[model samples]
Target chain A: MKKATIRNVAELAHVSVASVSRYLNNKAKGRLSEEKAKAIEQAIKDLNYIPNLAARQMATNQSKTIAVVVSNIDDYFSTELFKGASNILRVKGYEAFLLDTNAEQQRERELIKTVSSSFFDGLLFQPLGSNIKTIQSEFIHNIPTVILDRRLATKRWPQVISNNVTASKDATKYFLKQGCDDILILSSEVKIASTRRDRYSGVCAIANPDQIHLIELDEESYNYVTIKNKIESFLLKQKVRNKKTLIFSFKERWLLAFLPMLFADGFLNSDQVLITGFSDTKLVQTILPEARLISQNPYLMGASAAEILLKSLSGEDNSKNYEPLIVPAKF
Target chain B: MKKATIRNVAELAHVSVASVSRYLNNKAKGRLSEEKAKAIEQAIKDLNYIPNLAARQMATNQSKTIAVVVSNIDDYFSTELFKGASNILRVKGYEAFLLDTNAEQQRERELIKTVSSSFFDGLLFQPLGSNIKTIQSEFIHNIPTVILDRRLATKRWPQVISNNVTASKDATKYFLKQGCDDILILSSEVKIASTRRDRYSGVCAIANPDQIHLIELDEESYNYVTIKNKIESFLLKQKVRNKKTLIFSFKERWLLAFLPMLFADGFLNSDQVLITGFSDTKLVQTILPEARLISQNPYLMGASAAEILLKSLSGEDNSKNYEPLIVPAKF
Candidate 1:
């Protein structure tokens, strides 16, 4: 049987398609007579007319579409951090669109092209740890973009990020002040593109370069369990009678692995093993509320990113000295 | 310092800007001598020209753009379900841009306009539970779009969704065979929508209307604690000694509220009380692993939405089909 359309309903009801549509939408607002309204409703019921939401959307051109490209979906940092951007964008009357790079650089490049073609007024990119520099050039010319969570090697574009250097330095200092001399830093190679490098640099400022246990986790090669065991065994082997461990991570991927190990090793009993990490997810609060965490205000970062992009989109002079906005981390 | 541009590098190397660009891009291959390549690299380094990712995309017209609009970001189903769409869109030669309606019909209409103005090739919209008919009509005029998660009331476009009637009926049968005489149908008030209605019908198909308990949760005034307590007391006061309790929720929001009450009441130990709900989130696994969950495959739904949109964008007639693709529950 052929599917019924708006025209069919209109024809059967002996009215214009617009009137049928208005009646169906309840936009007629009593402009149509009572008899006409009932007839339109009956026609709709009899014909089983279903309107296409997407097709109707294409008629108007004054949409405020903004695309956000991030690394993963499961990460709380990615989603929670977006709260800031979403809140501001909503007030600005812009609809926020999300794109996940899934940590692939090629996919990131492809995403840029796809999002740009979509006529998005602006874009907010949170590149995978290592690929920030790889896609740096693509962001410059085509659209107004703000790089969030990651830092560019060259100071050419607008970016919003946490003060990784100072935050990491402070976190490491806290560990050092707690009388733990040898600390291990479980670092994400991806974060090196952003504050990870700065945080590592901060750690280097305190401890001897050799003293820093900078274990680089290969995201592509290791799953959560494999990395968990590695962190556990590494801590166990350190025969320093103190058995003090301060593990730091800029990305949450490592912590998902770290939490399971802490439970398996029976180290979750107390703060005996000092393990601190970055990110703010509801799960983090529910699972281990006591764990020391570096709360980089994602909401603020998102808002800032949106603000910068809007300014750029408004054709602000590229050479103007718009200072790089750095949000401090809350411990 | 004047930032180095392609033109500056070309002049310094005694070559055309195109030659300089090709050399910088490493597209030179065998066309340029090694000495020339060395000189071009030197000039590029001296000039400090940065490449733009968005501009690079303009050459191919394959911006690889895919717009994904969920009714709201706060809804667990919409975001989690988007995972499937995001994965598929990313894997294919496309990028997914997300839009959040905040569940407002007007915002959805505005989103359509914003998306069309941008460089997006197609759109995937998850209609608002409230006012879906009006939102559906907004997408009828232009651009290729694919609807996800719900069915349209009119046959104006194609939609991807679960086999609502069959799934709901199967769930109701599971409860009936479990020997639950009084099954409670817990759902959101937007039940007039097809999916919820199907679930209600499914319950009516097996159990007596008087024996079934219907709980309608209104969004405007949701007091979860009070509702849970009410349900708990009602279950305890059942006159029949053999009366097993079965709770069927429309989605996880109700489950999140109800399960905690059961656990608190110490009723969680009784197998006589079967708790199951429909939703698509990892939260189900984390909260109550034993509970039978209707796992709507969001990632797959999203991917299919992208696939359908891609086909339509490529000029294939992908409009108005009654047979929505059935995305089975993983659990």
Candidate 2:
């Protein structure tokens, strides 16, 4: 059977389409006569007309809403990603709501229940600590979703990951060119996300095994005092060889916490050590003029995910080309 | 005179309340026998029963949604306030959506149209560069609203503002006690918001006209290079006097940008000058240990606004007591 449209209701009731619409919206007022109102009501009953909301929802599984799952909404990078996605989503006539998991994989999994229970039409996941199995759900597969900046355990979902390898390798190469014999890579969590792991690997790719150093700070012990203590110990150990050393932090918080303490304690000498990290930290970069950075475009990555999700929502499924949309990092 | 209830429909239809509910929700399967379905339908028509969504909306003006208006959703302070409001709102089962004004007053006024037109049940406005006239809207007057931080032209609405005056005075007094002859205040924008004006007045209350110096950095002209140049000039003049000076910054961005440049130039000597600002810069504080802060609780201010708005929505009218709920700043 054909769907009942406003025009069909108008033709059956022998009323103008505008009048039918106004009556349905409760805006008919004096424009609709008593006889005309009764006639339209009888026509609506005869047609068994269910409202657009009820029928369309049952048929399409579309809410015109999108859910953006992030590690933390308050984080600088996640918000930038949200801004990017929202810019595109709003243009496409969709509303995006945010859910912050606070870097917990368990919460992300739990959040999926809410996302799938007719709350949203689509999902955009930026998992903090997740595997492929949880992401490739039977329920999620029914709706459109795009993952952003996180590597999956399997090649199942469309993804947009920034180029962590090239940027980290370039920063490391810069340090090696400056005659640095020892390089230390410090990060908040070593294996929580592939970004950190890839950054560590990129540095390893350039340097000899003996010359490379990696320090993975546990999340529970992440504070300026603890990070300062760790860096002090690391530098103390490196001093024995009198090697010209270089330091690379994988995230902004680590760089902000570590460098100020190191500079204050006279641990950084202009000629002895060089520093750089991957973060779009204008103020930190300005403050620490000697410390260079590998700036990545989180906003672009977010926008790419939104574009892919939009395409998938339309059933175009251009996931083949965008298995992993690679946004390059700039030094 | 009383509204027809679902229980009345169930009684008239000779069906269980659960069966009536299932039929109304379109959840009734073949188990609801054909006779029961027709009977319930007839009962609904005879009683002139309407769905909860339509009647509840018309009678209660409630969408169970609140819109939080801020200058920048991504800003450190604004997001902290949003987090506080969202925490309380979520407990009350209300979802908060964010709108970033990007510091434009005109855009906020335009956004009022969307907020008024079924987009939200209430408004929590944190205006930037907005005069009270623009905020005092006939549309907004009909809704539950609470102004946060920004002062209104009239005491018509509830407000939640941090104790900018008392905190600024204490910092100035501390500087005065330190025998500081020269005092300088650097702010992002002056006279835009009452919070800024109050902070400026608090400093003026303590210092003589010659003792107090004010520099209001134009927003359009604030970048690393410009900020660095301005701080360089300011510090050069302060250094020329050979007198112990005290510096106060009104916002975190200014302090973060200014201090690093000063430190790199070996210009920030703890013995020569003392620095304090109004922000809870924990990591920044840990990094720049010499710089003290007059910490204001943005989260508490946001929570206070949420509490008042919730009260107004429930018809308790707590605005009389909370005309300007002042959350104290800790130094």
Return the top candidate by TM-score. Answer: 2
- Per-prediction TM-score to the true structure, in the order listed: 0.63, 0.79
For candidate 1, chain B by itself scores a TM value of: 0.75
TM-score between candidate 1 and the true structure: 0.63
Best by lDDT: 2
DockQ of each: 0.07, 0.18
lDDT of 1 by residue, B1-331 (tens): 4334444666788865445545544444457778877787788677665533222222222346667788656556776667677677666666566667755667778777666444556778787663455664565335566778776665555688877667777777887787777777778764646667777776788778888888787643556656776777767775346578888888765665555445534565667778777877655444554666677777677777777777766767545554566677643
Best by DockQ: 2
Off by over 4 Å in 2: A1-66, A90-98, A106-112, A115-122, A136-142, A153-156, A217-222, A312-322, B1-64, B110-112, B119-121, B138-141, B218-222, B314-322
Candidate 1 yields a Cα-based lDDT of 0.65
* lDDT, candidate 1, A145-217, per-residue tens: 7778776754556778788877778888888778665677777673446567777888888777656787787
